[model samples]
Target: MTSGYLWLKAIHLVFVASWFAALFYLPRIFVNLATVPADSHAERERLLLMGRKLYRFGNLLMLIGLALGLWLWLGWGAGRFAGTGWLHAKLLLVVGAIGYQHVCRAHLRRFERLENTRTHRWFRVFNEVTVLLFAAIVILAVVKPF
Candidate 1:
């Protein structure tokens, strides 16, 4: 039973890693594309496509991870999350990460109206913040800080 629990935990971590990878990259991708002259047709097309793909990939992966995360929380995560200060802190970090993702999605929707520089900066900050937030999550999970 413990082995099975570990297995589920592994799956949960895999998806969580995937979500973070996409989160970290998507904004950087935007940053690079921002330098392209907005009037360039080919460049704009490429960027639009990239934005769409980011929109698709980031949301889908996180959603899957979120679902699996909740499943794990209910099913296999109690060992970590069971009524401890560390667990509560980790859960709060998770919520912060997810909330930031939603904020990114909302910002992504306004991609067209905003200048590229602004978008790059905004999403870059978003990514950076999430990285720190997730680092805290990982620390709390692993260190089990009381």
Candidate 2:
């Protein structure tokens, strides 16, 4: 691989890791938000602010990661990853991650509106989706097991 390719790959990995960190934590925050007493307005508002900011930051990281990934896949390494099932699977998982993030953002909006209808238990289950998706992505990328 060219040094330029290596650099892009490294940057892509960094942004992905950052994005996943936020993805992993944000739902836990939602779980906490779900349990806040109706009268704990202060804590509820604080969690809502943090969730909004984290979602925006995560979105930025996703964009950077996607751009760098495209650069690696096409601009710098065209034809290199072609016909790889693992790459396809990884891409699908990445898309799923993005969709999951969108769902979280929607939940955040609901919380902001004081209209969240899901229980803390539901969020706890929902949060595990990230872990499963991340694990599958990593395994597909590293193992390339078809």
Candidate 3:
């Protein structure tokens, strides 16, 4: 790989890591929000504020990371990997990660409206989904096992 490709990959990896950090923490916030006493208005409001900010930041990171990844693929000749099954699987996992973020947004909106019915345990499980997705994505990217 060229030096330029290596630099782009490094930057993309940084943003992707930041993005995944948000994904990993946002649901933990949800878990806390779910457990907040119904009468603790201040606590709920604080958690909601944090969630909103994190979601917005995460969205920005995801966009930058994805754009950089696309450039690396299309502009830096990584597109040659397009013929491989591993690339296809990796792309599918990327889509799933994006979908998972949206689902987190939906849950956040519900919490904002005070309509969330899910338990803390549910959010705990939801948080693990991102971890699983991250592990699979990394394995596919590195191992490229078909």
Candidate 4:
């Protein structure tokens, strides 16, 4: 592969890594934020703050990766997103990830009610989505569905 390909892949990997790491932690933080006891509202606050940071940073990485991927797919090649099936798969996974991020943001807003009603199981479901998302992203990038 050419140096440009190598650089593109490198940036994509970095962005993927950052996205997944944040994806993993953000949900856990959400789980914690949701389950925190009424008496421990302070802890809930902290978790919410941390989750916010994670979600924000994760989105930043995801966006940057999207830009790099688009550049690599279009400008580097014949045209953007022309014949890259693998890149298409990766793009789909990113869309899923972005959807999950939006869900997290919505839930974060609900936390303002201080209801603390969501259970660990609820978070587990969110966790499942991220896990699947991360797996799909990795597979698409590495396997390059071609």
Clash statistics: count for each candidate: 0, 0, 0, 1
**What is candidate 4's lDDT per residue for 1-146, written digit by digit as tens?**
58978888798778877877888887788777766777897797788888778778988987887788777767777255456887777777788888888887877777766654678788878788888888887887677668
Q: List per-candidate RMSD values in Å.
A: 2.4, 1.1, 0.6, 2.2
User: Candidate 1 on 1-146: residue-level lDDT in tens?
Assistant: 59987787788788888888877876676665666675686876676678678767877888887787777778775755577889878878888887877766665555566543465566567568868987888888778879
Candidate ordering by TM-score (highest first):
3, 2, 4, 1
Name the better of 3 and 4 by TM-score: 3
Model 4 quality (TM-score): 0.85
Which RMSD does model 4 reach against the true structure?
A: 2.2
Q: Which has the greatest lDDT? A: 3
Q: Tens-digit lDDT track for model 3 on 7-71?
A: 99999989998999999999999999999998999999999999999999999999999999999
Worst 10 residues of 1 by lDDT: 108-117
**Global lDDT for candidate 3?**
0.95
User: What is the lDDT of every predicted structure here?
Assistant: 0.73, 0.91, 0.95, 0.78
Q: Compared with the true structure, what per-residue lDDT tens digits does model 2 show for residues 1-146?
A: 78887888888889998999999999999999999999999999899889989999999999999888887787886447678988888999999999999999999999998899999999999999999998998898779897
The candidate maximizing TM-score is 3
Stretches of candidate 1 off by over 4 Å are 77-80, 114-123
Checking candidate 1 for backbone clashes, the offending pairs are none
- The C-alpha TM-scores of every prediction are 0.83, 0.95, 0.98, 0.85
Global CA lDDT computed for model 2: 0.91
